[model samples]
Target: MDEFERQSEERGWATAKTLAEALPYIQIYDRETVVIKYGGHAMGETAVAKQFAADVVLLKLMGVNPVVVHGGGPQISAMLDKAGVKSNFVDGLRVTDRDTMAVAEMVLSGAVNKEIAHWISVAGKEADVRGIGLSGKDAGLLTVEKTTRTKRDPDSLIEHEVDLGFVGEPTKVDPKLIAGLIASETDDWVPVIAPIGVADDGQTYNVNADTVAGAVAGSLHAKRMLLLTDVKGVMDRNGDIIRQMTLSEAQALIDDGTASGGMIPKLQTAMAAVRAGVEAVVILDGRRPHAMLVELFTEYGAGTLVKA
Candidate 1:
């Protein structure tokens, strides 16, 4: 055989070996629910988004129920800018007012949500699977309450309540709509959720997508909650990714200041989901292509795994 044919044969054998190794992991996740919080660079890049869609479709074909909860921070900001609406952030959470909330809803629930579902649908069309776009407003998926934060006054050494207007925290999560879609036998469906919620007073609120993902995963008792962020995973003081940790170890990272900035909240969300009965939470970098599949199906997972 020529060198090219020899190389092709070797590649084919490697592919077969990889699939053989994945069998156990695939069996472990069969008929299980995996809640993926999709955002970061992955959502913004076209090539990465297509890969993500294909991976989700592959998971569904393998009998894994994948529910996607997506965020549109950059998209929302861009739309708000085009609308000439100024935005403010307090403690890394957007201080969403009336106008801001309207733009947020338009961008998140309408544009971003549909785009993700469309990508998934396009990827799964050949297999007869499709993506269903949803939001917290649909079928009572989520009911939220206004979120409040406290800020410390530098001069007075005092703390005061800061109102993040129209920002919400999930007070109730009804996963029945999501459950029904994934449980259907005739048609395969993937639910892509946008994090726009409503309050009891008939007011709309913009919720943090990470918070929404955690709430939904908890409600569904998902087998795994995968938080796709920009970073590799939870890191040690040396900045090396830690492969696995229990709940207490994760808390210690926050307490000792090892986990800082946005990572603090991501860790908190992971802990909360685990406490709420998710089997585990994995924080992996979304920028890396096929990161979710690597984390789920490989022995050496792609990120930090946090468990109760």
Candidate 2:
């Protein structure tokens, strides 16, 4: 064979090998539900976003149900800045006011949600691509309660409550809508959810996407819950990534102050999901190409996995 012909033949063989290797993993995940928290710096990149869509579509075609919950902190911040609104944060949660909640709902549900669905629809085969954009308010998918945090005084050593207006936590998750989408006759509809929930009094609340994904996974009893963030995974004090951790080990990390800042909330979410019956929770770097596929199908899974 000529040089070009030889290269083409080798490429064909490689593709076959890859498919063969993935067969077992595909079987393992078949008919299983996976909740993905998609956001962070990764969503801003066009190439990565397109690749993520392709991955989710492929998973569905292979009989794995993928539900996506996305965040838009940076986008909301940008919109707020343009609107000349100031934002504050307490313990990593945004201090959302009434006006801020309105803008947040607009950015998350109106813009980010549709954009993610559009990307998935355009990247996959027309016959199989059915991306449905939703928010927690739709069909009451997520019921939320107001969140309160406490801060300690350094001088007096006293603790008091801090109110983060319009910022809520998921109190209940109704999985019917998501389950219906997954159980569609064609199995083509994928749910792309924005983390905006509604209270019983009909107030809109801005929730953390990670929290929403965890609650959804727990409610669905998903096979896997993947929280895609900018970081590689949970790390040690030396900055080395921890591949796998048990629920107790993860709790220890948090109790010892080894895991702090943004990671603290994420680890707590993972712990809650595991306790709620999820098989596994992974905190992976979304910036990596084919991150989901690699984590699910590879032996070395591309992140930190917390399990029972």
Candidate 3:
């Protein structure tokens, strides 16, 4: 590059860095929360996962409350396989029968939760990273009931009942106790939560982690909701990512089934956060190293941005 272009680029970065330095003072004590749904490629990839943890710690240091909620579908599946447990998925929901639920709890609460906590502490950040490993049974954090799925139109050929055995949805969310852990921290505390909800009859139910993240964020009235996944956020029909979109536009995309399959529920949960008064929602790829830092602190971020 020519000297002029090089100097221009340097100057631009210098200005941004200066602004970033000034950001804390401008944003201090601004009662805002951010819920991060960390999963998929991000959780599976080692470098990305640790970097994501570092980013969360940084956010807390910056006075931005980031509640970390994660899923361990891949890890759970692996453990179940190792234990010689047959795996099954009905309509994209895990058939969380008794044995499956036990493994899910162990992996999600025990393995995934603690790993995140350890990484956060080792990443040159001060975080009292607490692995608050829980299922829906404890604290009554979520109330879930059985789901009976059916077609959008009964007369349609594609319509049929999909029985997702023992899988639960986040029908209710209680953030009081969860918030206390963060707020009561004498030092920095990165609360790593596992997605499991409770049933009305005091039974435990396995819920989608994405649903858990959204409910937590909304319950906290977070400023932003960050969803880390495999794709580069919401894309157009032409395979181009839309940098920014409003809630209405995002809802339109979902209603039209442009974001179907597993993505459908994910988008719905994110939309739930925005509707509950978050400033924005970001759906981005977690494959890139330090993707969280780039997304949170710099321009040219990694994925689609959904706004309030």
Among the numbered candidates, top lDDT falls to 1
Query: For candidate 2, lDDT tens digit of each residue in 198-246?
Result: 8889898999999999999999999999999999999999999999999
In candidate 3, which residue ranges exceed 4 Å CA deviation?
1-31, 124-136, 151-160, 255-257, 299-301
lDDT of 3 by residue, 1-308 (tens): 99999999999999888677656543742445777888884586777767777767667766766678889999998899899998877667787788888888788878887888777777634345433444445677778887667755547667778766667877787877667766864755666788877778876777888878887788787777789888877877777888888878888988886776766776777778788766677888877676665666655666778876
Question: Each model's TM-score, in the order given?
Answer: 0.99, 0.97, 0.84
Model 1 clash number: 0
Q: Stretches of candidate 1 above 4 Å error?
A: none
Per-candidate Cα RMSD to the true structure, in Å, reads: 0.8, 1.2, 4.3
lDDT for model 3 comes to 0.74
Rank the candidate models, highest lDDT first. Answer: 1, 2, 3
Where model 2 places Cα greater than 4 Å from the true spot, the runs are none
Measured on C-alpha atoms, candidate 2 has an lDDT of 0.92
Task: Supply candidate 2's per-residue lDDT for 142.
Answer: 93
lDDT of 2 at 241: 97
Arranged by TM-score, best first: 1, 2, 3
Give the top-scoring candidate (TM-score): 1
